[model samples]
Target: MHFQVWLQSIQANGRLKVPESEDVWSLLPSFPLSSFSLSSLSLSSPYLLGIGALASLTVYWLVTRPRPMRPPCDLQAQSVAVEGNPSCRRSALLKDDALLEFYYEDTRTVYDIFKRGLRIAGSGPCLGFRKPGQPYQWIPYTEVAAQAQMLGSGLLAKGCQPNPEQFVGIFAQNRPEWVIAELACYTYSMAVVPLYDTLGLEAMVHIFNLAEISLVFCDREEKASSLMDNKVKGAVPTLSCLVLFGDFSGDLLERGKECGVEVLKLQELMDLGRQNLKDPVPPQPQDLAVVCFTSGTTGKPKGAMITHGNIASNTSSVIKILEGSFVIQQEDVSISYLPLAHMFERMIQVSMFCHGARVGFYQGDISLLMDDIKTLKPTFFPVVPRILNRIYDKILGSVTSPLRRTLLHYAVRRKQAELSSGVVRNNSLWDKLVFNRIQASLGGNLRFILTASAPISPVVLSFLRATLGCLIFEGYGQTECTAGCTFSMPGDWTAGHVGAPLPCTVVKLVDIPEMNYYAKNGEGEICIRGHSVFRGYLRDAERTAEALDSDGWLHSGDVGQWLPNGTLRIIDRKKHIFKLSQGEYIAPEKIENIYMRCFPILQVFVHGDSLQSYLIGIVVPDPEVFADWAKERGFVGSLEELCQNPDVKKAVLEDMRAVGKEAGLKSFEQVRDLYLHPEMFSVANGLLTPTLKSRRVDIRRVFQEQISSMYSKSAP
Candidate 1:
């Protein structure tokens, strides 16, 4: 049979349903060409057999092909420190013996970024937040600077010492007051320690005592009351004073007094500062700025001592990357919704300040994040992967009409084609007719959006690019490396890999012998060395030695592969892998990522340990999808009732298995049993980290019985 005849026959039989695109060659293997009957084809047995062999060879070649390792033209590689693989890489933007410490300002510390913002954008809108029935309110840079100075003075008057070891805690969400207190610590030589709710009361007490934190800035009265109660219980001995950011009742103050903790309203502290003003004492380069505790995704939270130089250099790297493509400006605004307690969001906010840009706070509501984004109408959005995932799922679920779905699919293809061809703008016909609504949801002025914290799927990234009508860049970093080591540059069109290392750092991968990942093969554990590396964990020399080497390389526990284009692709975890009873080493995150794509699954926790031969998943079902599923199946029940239905559980498990199979998960990797969790895995539930990454330790604790039962049921 002719080639055209075979192709047409396969197409006619519904075996070839891929969209026509430049990436068709890459998409061809995804279709089930094996289903094409050889008996009906006019070919000899040898010819048919050769066709199968050729197809297999082609697919293998495509799968194993090397990814690009060098950045685009003009940005060439300088050197490779590892043999056989160019595992060691730095941006050509950074020449030998060169680093970006201060790009926009002569900044030696975090306090300097604030000072620079005041110098360049004194009266510009700096920090902003919205009120009910009112537009966003703004605090100018000068006013913010003044408040920070006042707060710094007030702390000194309250007998807090001015030194890097003197930790001042801020236990609050993202707010102007949070920044003010943080900056206030930076103004002096004092270091800031952010407390997260994810780190429960025990961890909080541990951090407070470990760092000897005497005063904590609290935004909520309940938070203050909890701290006082803990203090009264003799859990936290160092607690001496409490400063409230918002309104507080007199009863809480009396309760604080009884606990021997001084309670002062935010304004009272600022007023106290008016009587005892002191000159700003900026920290030295190596002095600690923020002692960011890890969100405890794996185990106990460790305080990563982020120095002034670490953050200052990271901010410069961002500024340097955006200089030629999309420069940071005073008009550029970002909505700070992610936890400021984490290094990633804090880094983003600090970068905005260095550029004299505006930052608007969310209304402390995750559901209303997009509303805040729309209200602020930010020009650039910094977000996390889970948020984008929800948006992706929501957009897909909302496109229920068959005609509109088809159009949406084609529009995505056309826009993706345009994006790949180096055309990115919001005025295309596809944008006006198809994606305008999605764009409008993000305030309609976004020129680009950057997502970090976790890996976002390539499909979702492309969809965001096409629909958002803006550049979408993925960044990779950890709290250990001051939040960002590599960022997908502004011009790179393809996804999957987080782009090349930022100019501030040099990145290399070391061999993980047991995992079969080697630097010689262009894949291993990512290691970073430069000014941005943290200044060791607070009072934990043993773990700090493990994290940072004598040569100053920070060993990031994430496994990465170097692309041919110099971008880094996160492949697996250097930690978090569990060996099964059958000797299969399972990366639960890889399997979880696959199951998370299912329509009915909002979040999935895949668990398998040395004792279990097979995997079991605890799935948080999408509420809307779960209800729709029950309604379609003629069931009448609440979410909790539906979760207990055997048929519903079986259906969801099948869906997960199908998704895993489609994603090419190995047999051992595929989950055998599933428990439909009616409630989402959230920080409040003690099942997830603040950043939304699953706390495996916590999940295992919460579902210990369910997990054991699943293993028993799955035993053949």
Candidate 2:
């Protein structure tokens, strides 16, 4: 009988001789396959089983195959639509005036920004700091606001009036009190002048007199004592009061009185403010918020009058860029280890607070920075190249055995390949076996690292990115630009470039004919114009005129080139480029950066004269590396003796040659001869700026005799 007729007859008879377990197969009559006539085939036929298996496999393949991922732009759009607030969505589409309008749509001053953040953050930890050997303790945002209000009121009650032309000075390390003091100033529209803790007493006095500071906030009694010194007091005659974040002994207060100054503790000031809690004046967007002093690499430090709008606008732009590039959550944590006086760190602090991210201050000692980082487990870290170099050196030093070193090298190579190919066949296994430990050293939660202030070695950048499995971004800006004007976007991954101009900012390269730099040649001094630019240098009209032109472009004095992708690569400092007798322009800083990457070399200063054909260098060898080299060569003595040893000099020169070649430097640009210097250049030695940039003028002066001798010997 035919299969369909037999099946219908069995169903009608209700007596089909099928077992209960086989009854499920009878349900196949309800499926579309029922139409297929299989009566001619036996139940054990191979073709019937083959066709059924193929159909099942096809369905499994169709269901289990991977789908293509959405593009980054699409993902960003979706993220904004789903997670972002209405303002954020609107701000993303706004441009130029509209963008600025959007940023200022709800907030005008930093006080406004803080209040908005406080509203969202509620009772969350706002500022965090730790006692020695203790976990971090936090002060809530609401408490911070209340304290700042009381402090501002107290300052006003104590005859400290807000003056647009005058300022209050904050000379301290990063602390909760610093933020409270700054916020208090904002509450009363008082401009703050942040003094670098590393600054010499001379520089401190100079800035105090220059900025006409009326009152100063000191981090400790020691700092407060420094201000009470006769010379410091004499230089800044306008100074009338001192506020100490730490306790002051009776002797210290009496000394302050002798210096014609009144000293008060932080809590005492706050109590006074509570008593004077009346209508307080708020700062306008155009009001000056800070008088940030430049590093003074070449001359006296000029205070850049940064306004509320200048920093607020820059902070807003930075937040917008970072939000698009990274996954920033309110729960994100950060460590504030960089000098808070520096614009870079200060701007980051403002940005973090604005985003409601908790910030922890490191202990006063930098040696404990890693411990602090480990404890904080920060999600975002902003650093300078010096910090990165140290971290890289430590990691390299950890692999003492040759076999482990070789394994690490191979693993790093594999990681680079995996990142490049966008494939991870065994990433989880690799992470478990190798990267987890490294990540754990950094608290195992670091997602992004920002490097700026100076150029970093691309090799270091790549290695860090590969090993940490985190995005490393480079940014370029000076204090004049309110910290950042250009920054590498997440996932861009291109080395030696500082990305494009930030939204609401414009960057252009202008010709420097004297140095042979031209925009037409794709290289020139980078000039910037935007709301982020400083208004002008405080009380230095001549310098301000030199920096900012009538057209509103601030001449950066740093040379850069635009890549095909429109990213900016800093080439050299315009003022530092000197032409040789052969008419070849040489940038010592650029060459120095390359050679400094050598493991044995700690610092380098390349010098070339206008009449010279080749360059000479002053090399500072890494003490530990030099000691090892000295021991191997059977030389035993002080660092000075090791530096002067002929064999050590030869080894250094060889390493320099190898590093220079690897950097692809031109022959003339290479260091032909060098003088080994045992001392490391430092700000205290007057050889480096407060920001750690070498003071070329001072270095040249210090090494003038050696430079002359080297040139005299190489004379043709």
Candidate 3:
């Protein structure tokens, strides 16, 4: 018999009989027990009838039935979505008047852009950091949005009312929990105040006192426990809640309870929201969304009250400048590794979401960035100078053999030649042989990179561009201006200069007295005015009035000048300029730039004024570069010896002189003295700010004795 007819003959009721051959069973259609019952009953045996009747009943019961019901609602059902928001659209995010006229004439609402991100990143792989010691896990955005809503509802259910200006503190690192907390606040119309994770106990107390944070979402047990174990002198006395993101099997919760605080895990909070609440009220565009802290480089740190309008406006500006620069589309991916407390990464996050790009957070240990990047293969990246320097160090480290070294040098020259000839694509055999490996080491699909914070070395910039066969767009901005001010265009790039101001920005150069290195006529401190300019520092009217003057021009405190072609070259910080005893004004950044080119150090901060005719610097040595140097020289001991050795200092000083001669700098401006520290100066050490800018006051105070001893001869 044919396979279909044979299978029908064996059908016992609504199910098929066991076939003798596996292959034959695969080819047969599903069997019905009713057919089998009819066939068997006609087959002349009462014994056969009994077996067939039992099989038919079993098939009928199994095929169509419902399981027992337990409760009125499933706990999992709280994560459901009520779709179709008319207020949220991608077009509403674009608010720059000039940019709207130029590119993106259509506008998108904040909610619309967020929903688009939801649609674009739907069910895709995304990694996020929760805290230290905890593994960074991957989850879909659809799940993240659901969890965020549930958490928002939970906050409302816990007697936390979301007023238009209600402030909640997000005191954590660049983790997925931080993002969720911020989004949850937006859903509930509560403004999130992002505090730096590296802040000390004093700064934390001060900020809590100022912002009046009733509740805080922190990353680990340490931060949460610290807040609860002790009484802060001037902190928010009514602060009663601490929600930890990860495993809190320590004394943190008990300590919190002792201080009249309620401690809970992030998961517990979300479960509560899901169980008690149905839906959350989303924030409007005009709502006070976030309060970002400005870098206190010149004075005390102040909260910059940012509305949704501000965020939407800045993200729109970013979209305008980056429209055709790179190939990021709705399908591309980006990796965010920088701290979210800073405005730079936060703005990039919003922009990436609006662009319908998937974002993956880097593993907490940034030393493993290469592994993470290789895994994610992001198309969009924004990195600081320190990261780029490491990349340069890695590439140079691979050149060991003579033949390999020569081949690498030859490839670089050829790549530069192709770039000069307007051939940016790496389509040649030599490029494949040499540069392709280099690109692969950076996860291979890197289309564009944005570098900011501290200035990047030109060699690093050129090497990245030629090797990646992609663009590296350099941008300049500050927290006061909400992250981005001006960026280099794809076709218009000039090294050492951070391109022209943005389309909406009006930049003017106010000529000051001639400095040692700045141009006598053309250069001056750069002043900017635009919509992106912040309202004022929160609650400090005097300082705010000083920063934003009578004419609405925000004094950027950065010295720069516009070239005849309209390109702006930032010289240095205005506060960094100091006059020597001989009355020669010197910009320390100019001296440091020359010194960095001379030494293999990560950074050089120059300081000298009243005492000496020249400059001195506190140098932070690169560990990898020095380690290889020590290995090559047969020197042994520790990394500290390599940094603080007199021989290393002499060699570095010789290179400094050579660099001074090459740059044609005056003798007085050359670095006359240097003190090498074994430790790296970072934001964690209170030396550098979160954005990588040098905290001049703190650094100067820390190295005062060393600096005084170095310049004692000239003090008289």
Candidate 4:
């Protein structure tokens, strides 16, 4: 009776399904239970016992099977308690299916990435550098890796052990040696501390001292000399050696010796490395790879600690997005002109290298950037808005003829319409006649151009897209996120939005109640949490804690709003926004961007205070434009003298009003009074950051008296 009940339970559960044509005894394979023989029992009882025992064994196996192990780096599975809210748990942004696949599959370090690229690109040109009035010199991938290995061996031989805490500094402009030195450091797990070549002496001294950089690689003799100078060397006593990319002069060597530091040439180091080449210590993904300093627009520069995994993960996501949206091919080429010390350029370099793309460095002069662009004919160009503004001004200035200007205007409108309609049936004849020439100026093979660092004017963006006949993508990020957090994809041509967040990067808006920025209103401070976010500010725990919350979100000070299309639109910087006496909030950057589009204005600083009812501006007129205006009006004076002239002041004020109106700025937002300055804000003047962004605090301090006088005079 028990055996019969077991058989009935198995049948009810659908665990056993016998074929209609086959008998139950036949399906049992003539097998018997451990203690019962099939022949000894009746056929029906034998079948029931055999099926019941088989079902029991199957259930036992199912219940006792071992489970598969989970990956150690599964960020989503590791939840942490949020500070002040113990009930809330926060995890890394790994919910996206594509991001999860990438996270699990791509488990390589910076060194590993380089090796993979080398294997694929063997003899292909990896790094190219050109001197003024000379052809470009190309170094293949294999050669770069071999030299990097040798350099790593040489550094180890010279008592430079693999110490992740003690960093090596790369203080130079964009060059081939800069990248090679960076890679060599990775071979021995040394963190690279990149110092912007344009940093002030004091700033440079601060970084060298802060990071405790023992060895520094200098691009030229002058750089080595400047660092080894008596005054600066005293400030950075921790620096022990200098490696010059160029031939080390005896004078520079003597200067280093006087400073109690050793000096060696790059060639000598490479030779030493070749002699000492042996087993190398490879860097791990979690090891500190770089300590990139912020531009210090607000205060003293803070070094952001970026790990090998941070770079690898960010670069991989970037490559995936670019390839998906822009179809980046292995044969694509790029020109490296931006300061590589900035994470933006550095990230691009790594991504290009990862995909086996060739990179050509520009001659160190900005004036020759266009000439180099023409020669290199890069397929991919990453630029700042300043460069784009200059290009637009130069191109528009050249259209002196009315007929040509009219034709160009029509072409731009027609192209814009086609882009909006998304029905590009055929290329317009105007493209072949007018736009093709503009494209040729940018190497003709250009597919897309990337703009970042600041918000670009929509007019300029549209004009460039129409004229060049190439897609324009704007990406938003900071040093904290390894450069890219969000990017505008190909079909995402919204005028003001920065498109969507990159895969694996989760971007959300958080409330800034004091500033009236709220996520509920679709505007707030942009916060990010993901693989790309840096570990923290090196050696600055308080600042790091403030920036990165216990929930692991990096609270970016930038303010943004969500667009209707689910994209991000940067509104204004929370710190840069100031409330006027009338309780009107003004975004100086927005106003500055508007006035900058005016032909006469070269650079402008919009200033306001909570105590003041109106706005005042410091405008720097374009030298050439100002000269032309002065000549046409028969005004006789230097630029400085002309700035004080009422006529010139009135002309600039009128232009500002026109631009502000065109930009749809509110009445309270317009600059009511202004002062013309002949000199432009620059890094040398301590009024601009190395990245060419205005240092607002410094500017306000420097022009304090001028601003006060202007406000006093304008009082009713």
Candidate 5:
């Protein structure tokens, strides 16, 4: 691991991203590298250890940047402080170009990957599901593939065409049947348009007609009946057929006939397909594989047209990137609980399938997810930030006394020290004595956990890494890029930043001058261009044009800053940021994320306008947390009654302010006025989308009077 050998290794094995440390600060978090001693450098740390050439480069980088101490690499919260004018625009590509499709076979389509699995591990346990009181029953890869073929034939037998233009709808929860139905559609060169509960009746009607869905498969009779009702009312005129999984009463068929739609049982459809078997009509790379409708924060959900190439490319990129680090193996098992309708879960599933890994479905109850996890005992765990946050809160909340706190902190520090040195095993006394329960809760076999769909807090990320002793990879992506654009790598202990771009995509940052973000300063709007990028939104050219530039670059609305370690930190969203009257721009989402850590609040919406000088927030408090706070302070009221209490509101606002200050938010960034809403911002309330993201426009319109009142009262 010496310098020249590392230099030879870098030239041979890695494409070293030489940091322009001329303007950026040091690599270490504690102090400036200018004051750092070279003797302290580890020769085998994989940061091209301190040898002659690397040492000279490090010396040049540290000495050239005589800047003040930049903010810590692990951003505490809304801290994105810069100290110097950077000298160059920045972009990051793969550490090695040969990795883009290295582990991946020449799979041009999604079905090709499935076939590869069929060749490699045909007899292996593939999809597994569980009954209420029974163990998981697995369907072998060969059997599952045969079932998909039969179902695809069944789709054709029931007047469903194999044209890519004609989409078959899948409206069901995540299950074996949901996947089989999707794969069936792929088998016939057809596409699937997923229908979810969050879409609402109006949105469902829109999707049914927008995709001109003639036949749909659902798991429940209730969903089938509701969809039939829409068809009967002529709201969804093109919807003529309904397929329900499992058993159903004959009366449903009578109702379907009355509604002019045919209802077929899952077994009945399979029998029909078996009787009328046909050859597979595989799709080309450019053919539409799915029309994934995104649950957006505003307006009707837009359908993102994902091609076979889009999915295959993204899957290949992910597999290749994870090859040497945290590779998915044939023995690996993962529990499928996240929304399968979303590209994020679908991408993960495909990766698992490609490696012949086992995927088990949850029992469909959030409360029993842990029970299901223990039952399945998955080797690989995939999650979101919210899931990790709950684990962090629950673990910390259990420490009731000073002694326990001290012991916990000491254990965490010890584990964290070992973790920084690349040790991630449950071999320590602390792991056996204290963290075993935490690990056991997740079935105790997790080697790695991959989190995406949101940025995880550095504290929570670090805490989970220390306690669980698992390599937790933080990924940043959206549906637009087929779920993953940048994923953190192994051995990178630094937090608050997503890792470098995948070899499938080239990530670049362009200056967003209006927001004071410059690429030369290592800050700007992130733009991605590569095979993994999705095709434009289905039939929505205007938005597609807005997202994809004249060049191939897909302009991510997210603002990113390149870290000294050549990683990207998502700092803000350009579309969501608003400016105050005094000209300081406010990123409401960034502030909201920080404020969400406040105990009393369950959900928060920070609003700022150019006409206003200060910010206002509408928070939906956690009833339990509020009750605890009220009881401790001799206050008396239900959540509704407390919302009207000036004292309660004042206390909540003060708590928010304190949390914001701790997160290092500036005065303007802090909410000056607060409204405690008794009601939750749920999907039913029109404030949240099905995905639980706040619908800002609807929330604003619904609480316009309250917003106006808050601003008026706070006015000078």
Candidate 6:
């Protein structure tokens, strides 16, 4: 009998199929059942038979296994959360799959989404971010969209096209006009290229040259007017159209004309989009949505080609992550304060649109962030670590009297205990006696706090977690990844790790023996592969090839390791590591993080190599704390003087040493000598990125003299 014929025979005979078929049927062809004897099959034979059975079972299990998922909350809740918000609606429309429908199925395109929001919001004012003393105005979404259409039409009339490839530059700060200009650009299927507000003219020229941007939208003539006033004829000869967002009068237009640049009021362009809508709204999602510039820390900025699909996917990933954590419902609210030019905040804004969450725009400037939070009573917060750190510092600084400080610490512990239980007390005697106005001041609706951009200090993390009663999640990704990669679960969080890779996102470590830096166990370069990884760098094939390998893994350029619990820990940038003469490499960020944790210091740059036998640091002491400490001690001096004093130096050094011991650093690695400086490194100073990470090379160069003096043996 043949194997196949015998298997059919076994089935006819009503016995087990797999091994029984093999044993009684297939094996009999070799020997014959008539000659077989069961008595010879002993315990060892049974063990071998059992092993065979287990192997078959394993294969069967493998074939039938269920798929993995980090399940999100009820999908229905996400669909309705941003019901009446224009920005939220735009995000949803961008993210929604044609196969899957949301509650508002008709909402499509940025135009349609805003139109629907207008219908839903009815007569309400669509508040824009404002400057202080500027009267608040509500431009309804209907009017806003109409105005955008008019401006888009005006551009088309001015010889701009409805083509999907033409690029328009939106170079301005966050404001209503910025949004309107973007919407107008979308109406004509023109790609809106975002320029950094703080970029110097040289960098601006590079972008304009590369992008071939003809039409530029800026907030005021004060912005573009300054360029005209400076007699800087932009290298962009093709740059024909310039539109000012705010009210621009005669002199500014005359100034622009002198520079040979034609200027139009933002309102005039918006009116054009409206007039052109009589023919048709020409833009669609298939058109490129934006051209966001990459942060040029390593080289000149290259545009990352962002499509509506890219924006939508990233937005969905964020929404799904939030849905998993917050169970965000229809009434949940969020505040948008971060720069829209950056991917981190842009993707979040898109997510808000998709989820139907109410989004409040901050009234211009981050100093008003707390005020905005209180006014909106937002259920969600998306902030960088610097802001969170400042908040933590303020709370810690408020304890004046020694006895009162002791009592406050105990009260915080008690509050943490109450938080551990599900019951929250806003007006309990214990609460009134303790947390009080601080809790009320934060506006109480702050339930979901999302921190990103840079690694947050563990101290700030723990403090917020203990007090806020909100679940704060840290997300990690790059602009190249379109902001969809990994996020720490509010429930399953570990400080310093950026959670597990997001669902459907594959993560791996590439061993870089040349780099010699490894995870704690043995580090490797972190690589991610997924739908979210960018197609490639725009117009830079060589650079794109360097970043993305043949198999489509994006080499993240970040050194990372898996925590024991399988969370991802980003250690430092590959470019950030430097070697001493001894050939020992040091990761500056790790050492800097330790210093930040050990002291109330805001920023520190640790530098030393062949020039010095050991490391020395330039510390930027926290000004707020230092000032208060000085005032309390009846100390009077300039900010610089306070930082240079011998007493202050001794105190800061002790803090550094205490931090070193706690972190268990080796003698050679610890800071041997350090100098305190009054001024903190900031984005405005070119020492930090908008994300609040120190530009290590820039810092090293700025403090080169201070560093050289510190390492000199006779200098002290």
Candidate-wise lDDT, in order: 0.83, 0.76, 0.68, 0.77, 0.79, 0.66
Q: Clashes in candidate 6: how many?
A: 27
| Residue range 1-716, candidate 4, lDDT tens digits | 33454456567986653334544444333443466665767758756656667755654554553322222222122222234322222232234223421332434677777777776688999999887777788999988988898998888877887857759889888888999999999988888999875567777887877888878898888777788873343777888888988886787777766778889988888899998896768888788999999887777789999988888877776555555345555688889988888888887777677767888999988779888988888988999888888778777777868898898899888877666643222245767877777777888788768898888888888788777767688988889988878776545444776766666476778788877888777788888888889999988999999999999999888888766545678877876888999998888997898898888788899999899999999999877567666666777688998998978787788889998998898888889888899998877688877778998888889989889888989532
Worst 10 residues of 3 by lDDT: 73-82
Residue 555 deviation, candidate 1, in Å? 1.8
Count residue pairs with overlapping backbones in model 1. Answer: 11
Residues 86-189, candidate 1, lDDT per residue (tens digit)?
67877756655365666755876788887887887979999999875468999999899899889999999999888887899999999999998998888888
The model with the greater TM-score, 1 or 4, is 1
lDDT of 2 by residue, 477-558 (tens): 9999888888765445647777766664667787888777887777888888888889999888999999999998899988
Deviating ranges (above 4 Å) for candidate 2: 1-104, 230-233, 421-427, 581-583, 611-613, 624-641, 683-686, 701-716
Number of clashes in every candidate structure?
Answer: 11, 1, 17, 0, 0, 27
| Per-residue lDDT over 329-423 for candidate 6, one digit per residue giving the tens place of the 0 to 100 score | 44565677787787887666554444444456777666776776776677778888878887788777887788878887787667555444423
TM value for model 5? 0.84
lDDT of 3 by residue, 186-229 (tens): 77788888877556666667677777777889888877767764
* Candidate that scores best on TM-score: 1
Overlapping backbone residue pairs in candidate 5 total 0
Between prediction 1 and prediction 5, the one with superior lDDT is 1
- Model 5, position 559: C-alpha lDDT score: 92
Evaluated with lDDT, which candidate comes out highest?
Answer: 1
Model 6 whole-model lDDT (C-alpha atoms): 0.66
> What TM-score does model 2 achieve against the real structure?
0.84
Which 10 consecutive residues of model 6 have the lowest summed lDDT? 85-94
TM-score for each candidate, following the candidate numbering: 0.87, 0.84, 0.80, 0.82, 0.84, 0.78
lDDT digits (tens) for residues 1-716 of candidate 5? 23234356557766544344323233223223464466766665455333434645665765653222122223222112122323221122233333253346557788887878777788999999998878999999999899999999998998888868869989998899998888888888999898887778887887777788889899898889888788778899988888889777887889888878888888889889999998999998889899999886667778988888888888886665556557678888989988888888898888888878889999888778998999999988889776787788778766768798898889999888877666677757899988898899899998878898777788889888899977788888778888888877556667888886665676777888889998878788888777777888888899999989988788988899877666788998887887899999888988998888887777899998999899999998876557766767777878898888888888888889999999899999999888889898876677865445688988899889999998878442
Better candidate by TM-score, 3 or 4: 4
